[model samples]
Target: MAKKKTNEPKTLKPEIAVGVLGSGSFATAIVKMLVENSKTVHWCVRNEFVKGAIELRHHNPTYLTSVSFAPKSIKVTTDINELVSQCEIIVLATPSIYLSDQMEKMTCEYRDKIFVSAIKGIVPKANDVVAHYLRDNFEIGFRNQAVIAGPCHAEEVAMERLSYLTIATVEDEVSEKLCQLFSSSFIKVEPSKDILGNEYSAILKNIYAIGAGIAGGLGYGDNFTAVFVSNAIREMEIFLEAIYEAPRDVNESAYLGDLLVTAYSLFSRNRNLGNLIGKGYTVKSAIQSMNMIAEGYYAADSIYRTSKEKGMKTPIIDTIYGILYEEKNAEKQFKKLTAKLT
Candidate 1:
């Protein structure tokens, strides 16, 4: 018995079929991007109504409604197996919390398919990132796995605003092909082999965005935010080095740029979640109010537990976990955080 060589490139034709799994704003945006390059995309919409709306109305009824699609270009279905069987490449855009259940619904094989994770949070109960979850549970190899990370937001993508995306995979050809598939006049695609670093950075940035939003909601001005973000990146660098130790640039768009956008952008759901909490809403209440999933809310506990077990001192992560999970006062937790930041 021999182990499979995961890096051996599989033949990806120029006319490869693509599928997007999820019906959220980001998923809608990704479908939009794919249609620009590929002829038809197999889309799995879990909600029958949303699937109907997309197929019949040519737009997502709930998210990114402004961006219309050609009905002929999208093959919309509620069945995950239907979509998986129809496509060679699958982009997972589901909320991390729902991912395991969604993956469980697939009865088809995934070993031959190329999976790109657009998810930025850890899987809740499993405490694994999407890439590892695919490997551990589905036996999908690293070469078959890729990640789509943003400094880019869905709203901006819908508006056709110029944005940057980093496509990361251990296999160079996989990363390059994805980059080619996803790039457009308004979208710039960069390639990287640092899949772990990029994915971890994507997850961590959302948690830090919550910290920024809390500061904003608490009436802290630009001066405090500037210092807070600066400290956040340093904290991110230390944590990544301690865990993965990859020779990667922390200042790249996939790292620092993603952090900046999530922390400061108006479209950030994680920041919005923190704002509600900072304005004195209970965690349960704030979560109930939003229609979207805030990755930071889930990532906080997962990162905290993992960091503690690994014996990494993450004061910012600790402060956020206390404020969110331990029921600590936001003002006091942030006050303590201020002392540790400089």
Candidate 2:
């Protein structure tokens, strides 16, 4: 696998078929971005209802409504086998909870094709990152694929906001290929070898985002938030030290940048759910109102569970799980979390 030079412009093939494994906002946004950039994409939607919705409306009305696609521009399917057979590059955009089930049914003929994982959480049952799941299940080598993590918001792409993502892989060829595949006028791609570190940082930020939102919901001032986010970074670093080689700029665009944005941004359902919890809504109520899967909600369980099994300290993740799932008081949990941080 050859390493590609960063920021060096290279020609891209005009006709590339990208397969998207989920019909969620992230998947829709990525596929739509490719088409808007004139790249062909195939997407899999499991239910007949969603397939019909996309065909009739030209958009995934349930997940991402602001962006629409032409019926002929993107191939939308209910059949997983068909999607796998046709795609050159497969993007697993499904949420972490559903990832295992989706992978179980998928049989890829293109073992040599690039597998681009846009999923951002640890798989709960296996406690595995997306890349590891692909490798163990698909028997693909490091050079066969890449993972994209970032501060990117799928909603922003609906407004065509310029965003950046970090592509990390041990194999230089996979990283470079992913960088080229996802790069467009609106999407900027940077490559790194710190795949594990990047994934951990990306996952931890969600837990912290819930904390920030709780603070916001409680009417806490910026002074509190600044300290909170700083400790959040420290906690992330402490965890990553054991699991990864330490990535450059985890506090920058891909890691901390994502944390800041997701923790406070209007587009974050995780933050929103935290806000509701802080405001005294039950987890069930918040989830019902949001009508979405906040990966952070699920990640709290995975994070806390994995940390417990690994003998790692994760007060932030535990605090979040307590509030969202255990029905703990948000203010008390915030206090406990802050005390631990200090």
Candidate 3:
């Protein structure tokens, strides 16, 4: 018996077509992983030059220059709305400071699509994580949203080195789909149920990494750094438990692993910014010199303001905020900060 073909459309997996937004190292790395699985990655950078360069040169002229793209592997554009319309999953890798300006250009409804935030910082002014921001503004419920946390760095990913990624989502199907999209010979994917915890851990770790860099800049040795990081993880675990009581392991790669890498890695821009600040460059000067966004710089202020509202005691966060925002002396502030840490 021959099976008859009907006028029916074939159903695809929910997030097979993935779109990426941003023009940074992390965003490029994401497209790298997606290319391994997806036929064509729909990517939206900020402007025409970036779009043209990548399409013409088979490489991003801005970041991750060594990683070339296959011809026709990436469908690059400057229009966010167009990218969203064609893809089932959208990965936001833009820095937090620029997210609002980029998102403002959007005119499409996105609640039906799966959104994965690779951003590790909170949206400024809103003083809220991207999950909440998307929920409030875009009407995308938590179920359709996910987060990508790294212990894995994009530089390492570009090298094809072994790396691990933690994908956090409340929905099991999302985790499964995202896992398949990113899994490769060099990458290992782990799914987590504590989405909020992973997101906050990602944010807080960068702040602590800055503090670690400050300590290094001030000539503090590895001994002090070890203690500082230990306390940072404890602080992160406490904050996570206070907000959401779930069966989450703080020692897992998503939380503590991400913290340690950002704190110590040479590639961490947040720590580099703090090092410059601790070495006596003004926050303004440190930021201007870097030419990259150190998310912790913005996150510190937002977290401090939000914590005050929630009645949370985040001494590390407060200390960093004071140095970065209030123009407090870094040396004096950190001296006072040490007494609060065990």
TM-score of each: 0.95, 0.89, 0.94
> What are the lDDT scores of the predictions, listed in order?
0.89, 0.78, 0.89
Write the residue-wise lDDT of candidate 1 on 1-342 in tens digits.
899877643334477789999989999999999888888888998788998888788999999999999988899998888888888889999889988988988898767889999999999768888888888888898899999986989999999999999998988777767876798888999888877888999999999999999999888899999999999999999889987898888999999999999999989999999999889988889889999999999999989988899998889899999989999999989988888988
* Model 2 Cα RMSD, 1 decimal: 4.5
Pairs of residues clashing in candidate 3 = none
Worst 10 residues of 3 by lDDT: 6-15
Give per-residue CA lDDT, model 3, range 241-308, as digits (tens): 77778998889999989998999999999999999999999999999999789999888887777777
Question: Model 2: per-residue lDDT, tens digit, 1-342?
Answer: 888766643434445667888888888888866775444578898688998898899999687687888777888887777887887778888888888887778665768677777888878767777777778877877677777788888988878889998887777756655666678778898887777777777778888887888888888888998888888887787677756656476576778888888876889877887788778778788778887787787778777776777677767777887887788988888877778876
lDDT for 286 (candidate 1): 89
Give lDDT: candidate 3, residue 103: 82
Residue 264 deviation, candidate 2, in Å?
1.5
Q: For candidate 2, report its TM-score.
A: 0.89
The C-alpha local distance difference test score for the whole of candidate 3 amounts to: 0.89
